[model samples]
Target: MKQFLRSGVVAATLAVAGVSGAGVALAETMNVTIVAGHPPVFRWVKHASQTFIPAVNKALEGSGTTIEWSEQYGGSLAKVGEELEAVEEGLAEIGLVSSLFDPAKLAPQNVTYFTPFVVSDSTLVSEWMDKLQSSNADMKAAWEANGLEYLGGAIGIDDYLLMTNFPVKSIADLEGRKIGAPGPAVNWLKGTGAVGVSGNLTTYYNEIKTGVYDGVIVFASAALPGKLHEVAPYITKVGFGAQYAGGFAANKDWFDGLDPAVQQALRDAAEADRIAYHADLDASVSKFLEIMTSQGATVTEVDEGFRAQWAAGMDNVAKVWAEKLDDAGVNGSAVLKDYMDTMRAAGAQPVRNWDQE
Candidate 1:
């Protein structure tokens, strides 16, 4: 997934055209392809791409620069774990990359997903991320070093919950259960003694049906689209908390090559997409819950004490992650602290600190 920018080829092609131009000849249309690991029905990635592509085209309407899109959703272009590298290597011009799935590449920022019960409000989460991106230099460098540029991001779904074949009434109920969790979510299995099987929202259905696992930890918004209610009817809101999910990124060289106006337009479009996508997700939760319940899913709210117990059970993986990154010469601890401070200022109450709490 590597893309090479050939300035010499462009210049040679322009010279061969017999148009002796003193200035660079810009293309009338820019063919931009956006890739998503999830299916088109996933709200965050789907709606963001849907909202951005049109707004970008509208911004370039009279500029004679048309924005064309090629969306490869449902892991068609890049699988769940391959998004970060796919974008870094320019497999697609732009892509929706998940930090949780690519911890090795995203590290400190990905630690946020591992820190349970840190932030609950999606709006605050999204707003705080915006502030972090603007003020945090290390955060910027983290992405820049990967040959990518972050436009902006959206908060995906709400807090995660456990949807299982058996009702989760207590922490002890989880013992010995083969639970399906994403890579970052495996930390939740600590102390509970639950057998954690790594899986994503995309694979939950088939895995659960085939008896690969007894239950799955996922957000209702995403689980609804996959019809998870039918198979796993017991829903326990264990408060895994809100995740930053993923965001749009482009090849740095390709992004820098764009005109300033076009660059601003693309950024503006992505910001708008972030707001709209989060709002849509916040609204969709209740609607999906109703739909899921009507279809015979038993939705239960876990006791607040139990939720706290679960949050406390997982070790502060953030510090472990930061130390790992520090060994690699990356300033992960500072980035994590700055993000936590910004989130707190934005009205978020973190349950623990990555450095010291």
Candidate 2:
């Protein structure tokens, strides 16, 4: 590729087939390190390499500025729960900071988890979170206070499901058993007969295998790839609902120091990542479930009557969630009302009105 260039000089040079004259002068390459707690097997991590890196590289093409990405994924740079701190400390300039793991720092961002049974379309949820980050001052400030930029979007995890070793024909099927859920998602199991265990994707399989828990409330995009189905073949589609669990972010100091064009490219690339990641994720969910069933997992669909029963069985964590943060002065209730209202105005019929009641 460098051979196409007549010289590495920063001056207007002869036009190449794709690059322009102005692009001739800017042959500078900047290195950006990106990390994720989970590895590339997940769609978010995969798109970061496929969609984001290429989009940023393509967006900055003509200007001669190129980003040499040092992508450190799979917990190589930071463990599952430590990604926020890694980016905060600039261990990596950018990362897929799992807000699900850093709930205390990013509580408002977890609104979707609290208000389940709304939108199952993961892409729509991603757009909602993106819009909130841009339109809400409190959402942006939540990240700023933590030394990171929210980047305007998330790598939407597909709708959540209940995958377990035992067949769940009804809510009573899980009575007295242990269910593993990540972060605040544990709250999803509240009021149910099952005990909720705090667990993450990396540990779900082992914990279940070792009998630490009976099953997990997880997403198909991850549960399929992680082979949780092999151990826990009974998958009850409880409609735990999709969520904007985490997203790409940048270290404020490192991001603020970049050239304006580079910064714009990073932001633009993040948008690209958002669209591509969710599109791929939206498509992957059904396919993943099919693949899981084909490989011996029993997939069950909960009836409307049963889904309502399950939702009612859970505590109103959203209310508790809102008031907890409201006391911290984070406008949690406002964010909740805005999110649900936006979703409703967009033609969604939430099974439960989280903010109102």
Candidate 3:
């Protein structure tokens, strides 16, 4: 069974017997198990440990309630994409639920990926996604439907780069090439003539090394740690834009049972985590690019014309994806339009207005 409040003898005494000074019973202490699929090596997971936990602890200091936190990360408790189920089923109270991996269930969470080349600023993407999750009914329903509450620690992936053994100057160069892409990002290769194979960070390096695929569509923050530059030395700055991979989420039943102060503390801590994660991630992108080049990787940014051509060459996968979701009763078109409109209102200059098309 799911462990909730572990009210020991001390907690019981405090709860039943009113304090001498305040004459009020103390709230029972909570036992919260936080889970994440990614290890501490990633900024998102690191911030969850270093920033979010501490913030929650600090926030609840004088609130008459305390919590015992259990952190299970790096697939120890739940693998990537399984976090939602873990929380929903009461295996964990909270987790870093990756919407990128759970595309079918959390289809609305991947709006940014479906419409790439919109914005490369991780902070911007994170901020806007936080707002959408909080204010948008469709976005919030996605989490609530799964028995989870959206906690707002949005994971913003930096601008995606094409890391390959061969240099790509034009779309024609990708003809017949087997390129690896993560989740919904494979659709970005449509109409470009490249064979987009489904792959992820964990397998990109070995896959490229052993000739499983020629290259991968990846981001710098992850590329540096994975040492992908060593295998795929030609890094093209494709600028697929920052992506909202996922965010912190908690089991709704567990959350609803918590004190209002405790619930607010979790939400506040999530905001803190989002800020710290994005700041660290933003700083790492340029540093990682320099480091990759210093280590003999050739990093080149595609020209504006090339970027435009690439965006133009790709089919309107966003529309197709949104329509498919709408057909399934998720209101995908509304999400797509809202995301694009929100980004534009926030000063983003997208290479292609996916919603317009």
Candidate 4:
């Protein structure tokens, strides 16, 4: 048998002893490597191992196929935002490709971040994005263009909020404040009088404590785990809406050449991973808030009037974003309108009609 290499398919024949002593049953064995920039501590990455791999194993039972999996997480194989490139290059068979970090390649996936205050339901955002990838030509093309296949494990981040040292009774308090936001989320801070800097979960704590930033726009699910509440104890619930961060992707060439049963098994496991991740995330949100509050962090929910003021105070970055993508030939305007309309039809009333502007 030829050795299984890291970059491509590795298949072998395995013989299982027959109980009747008539002969040995032959089965196909494949080696698969999964990668993620995030460690297993995150719900998405955690479920990838706890739920996805187990589910795939169960689905492939009795199918004459067995998968040997190698999980390289926490930047062992690829750092944040590089999973797509790694998979596309065949360094790994599959990966939890984070669109939040890879903005240029996965532009359409950031539609929700551009249009905030739409809805805070992570599950809803995950489901709709998955549907769009299957139905929307441009969205599907984004993955195809990169030589990757979307495999259904949608990573839906919880609603975003502000964690600052200073109290935020109104937008006026944010003036002259240096706030850090992730990726396109910096656009959410436009015209708010605060200076927006690009940042991410990995560095938010030390940055805020060291005076690099006065505050950070983050989510509770991550804030608690990241211990961001310890550094920035004043928590303001902005409800910037849940976001579709990314999804599972496989190397196109490798995935396309797999047996149909193996392919279906991977997809089935990805769906299970999505469901388990969202459930874990949803159950943790309020519980995390309570935990943070007990630890002396003050949590405040902005009233409707204040929320409206915050929404209205921003520039129409959504329009700017769409037009920019449209100029790049990605049909950004259509995606923006489609996302906003879908949310509205699902009974979500935005604080500001970004698409309308």
Candidate 4, run of 10 with poorest lDDT: 1-10
lDDT of each: 0.77, 0.83, 0.88, 0.88
Work out how many backbone clashes candidate 1 has.
1
User: Residue-wise lDDT of candidate 4 within 1-357, one digit each (tens)?
Assistant: 112233332333433473342354556677889999987877788899999999999998887777889999999999888999899888898999998888899998889889989998999889888888878777889998898889998999999999999899888899999999989999888878999999888789999999999999999988988899999999999888899989999888888888788789889889989999999999999999999999999999998888888888888889999999999999999999998888888878888999897
Clashes of each: 1, 0, 0, 0
Please give the distance, in angstroms, between residue 308's alpha carbon in candidate 1 and its true position after superposition.
2.0
TM-score, cand. 3: 0.94
Better of 2 and 3 by lDDT: 3
Give me the displacement of residue 344 in model 2, in angstroms: 0.9
Residue pairs with backbone overlap in model 4: none
Pairs that clash in candidate 2: none
Tell me, by TM-score, which candidate is best. 3
Residue range 240-354, candidate 2, lDDT tens digits: 7778888878888777766788788888888888987877777778999999999999988989999898788778899999998899999998988989998998877888998
The TM-score ranking, best first, is: 3, 4, 2, 1
Clashing pairs in 3: none
Please report how far candidate 4 places residue 175 from its true position, in Å. 1.0
lDDT by residue (tens digit), candidate 1, 150-223 = 88865454888889999887889988999998887877788787999988988899899889989998988888
Give one digit per residue, the lDDT tens place, for model 3 in 101-180: 99988989989889989999889999999999968789989988888889888999999999998988778989989999
Query: Which stretches in model 3 have alpha-carbon errors above 4 Å?
Result: 1-9, 13-24
